[model samples]
Target: MSDTPDTPPDGFEFVVTGSGVELAVKRSGEGPAVLLIGGLGMPSVTWDISGLPGSLVDAGFEVITYNARGVSPSSAPDAPYSVADLADDAAALLDHFEVGPTIVIGYSMGCYTAQSLLRSRRELVQALVLFAGLQPSPISAMVGEMELGLIDRYGEVPREVLVFEQLLTTLHHPLLQDPATVTGWQQVLSAGYDSLWTAPEGFRGQLTASQQWITSGEPTPEHLAAIDVPTLVLAFEHDLFFPPDLCAATARQIAGAEFAQIDGVGHGGIFTGPGDSAARITEFCRARRGL
Candidate 1:
């Protein structure tokens, strides 16, 4: 809700990447590592804003969170990077910090990257907290549905303004909250939208890349099922993006994975608001680690 990204309770800082990108990395508390990977179009600082990382820190886990590539402080390399590449970045971050057997907490697009980590580097990830992450099959159709819904809602408008408004509307869903909180979230999202629009060409490029990937449907349940680590799939009951049905389906596909539906929340609710979902996440990780 604050205009600026929330400050860390324990004061964390940047960690430089091999490619000269100084990814913002924050750490608090001390114990087995629990890495928090954020959703799309948000800085690493959002975790602080939501008080998620700090809560985990307070609970005595070595919590690590960071901005993903091409988002703010993280380097936006010219070369094309897929979800797999983003997963590699996660591994690189762990390697840089000399941490392993991590419990990964991924939300939204970060969920895709988290699965990539499990698929690519299974040994590095001990457990997973998949918040609003589901298999990619249903996701493609969902996007189309949103575009159509926007068309119906807005009737028609200039492509540019429509895209902008659509961006704003799409950014918040599944979690209806207090008007004040909604306003605050709008401010943060607006700031992010400004950043997203600043590099129009780059933004479009990324969008196109994402669209191609989503439509390709190459990353299916079969691909995700390759991951053999312990996983907890957290779904919000009213999430418009990744609904509880999809999350449960994802969990069912994974062998021995646990699934829990978070009530009275939306897609992004786990990270923000009262943070009841975040507490559940910490408990899940702690139970898995026997901490």
Candidate 2:
């Protein structure tokens, strides 16, 4: 909701990659390291709103968050992008900060990059948390293509319609039922939709990256089973993006990965009301670290 991509929070700095890309990075608290890979078109600062980083920081882990390439203030080199490229950027960021074998958390779209991280740079991750992330769903893929098709056919979905569609899938029935809550979020989402989100082609970058993932058949069952790190697969009860069933399936694929579902929430609820998610992350990380 904040338009200050150029102005990050205290303890924030930029990490320039060998490829000459600049990543706007933020770090908080102190202890062991936890790197968070954000969702599509999601700003790193929003992690603070989720109360996730502060909660983890309070629990004795330094939290690191950053805007991926194509997200504003970070280099958006080209229109279409690859998760491997994005994961490499994440690796470079972690390398710059000298954090390793750290807990890696990914949500929604970021989950793809996180998977790539495990396959490509296993040394950087100690424990894994896949929040509302999974391989591919036919229905989800259909929706993505439909949206892109609509974009190509027409200009962009009407702002009002886009907001409505976003809510229909993002929030659960309870949040949408609250008149004041919906109105508040509608205003917030719309106000910021064009400025930092679409202005730098962030939204397109996200959509294309996801489409490419669905196309490539990444992190196949074999790939998931091959992951040697401790993994926690987290799902929301009513998430259309990555439902509990799919999340559990992903957990099943990963040897020794634990699965947990947060009730009474949707995809967006994980961040909007993050107490449950934060608790889950802390519990799993502590258990893995023998704390």
The sequence of per-residue lDDT tens digits that candidate 2 reaches over residues 1-291 is 112356544666878888777778888888888999998878887777777888888888888999887776666664566788788999998899887688989988888989899889988888889888775567678777876777678856567876887788887898899999899889988987675552435556667788889877765888887988888888888888788997787789898988988888888876666547887888887776632
lDDT of each: 0.65, 0.79
Instruction: Rate residue 60 of model 1 by lDDT.
Output: 84
Give the residue spans of candidate 2 off by over 4 A.
1-11, 154-158, 198-200
lDDT of candidate 2 at residue 259, scale 0 to 100: 90
Report the C-alpha lDDT of model 1 over 1-291, residue by residue, as the tens digit: 002123422455656556554455777779989999876555676677667677788888898887766665444655345677677888888989888679998886778788778888887898888877564446445564454455457642235553444333343443233567556665655555655421333233334344455666734778767767788888766666677887787688788888888776555564544346667777787788752
The best candidate by lDDT is 2
Clashes of 1: 1
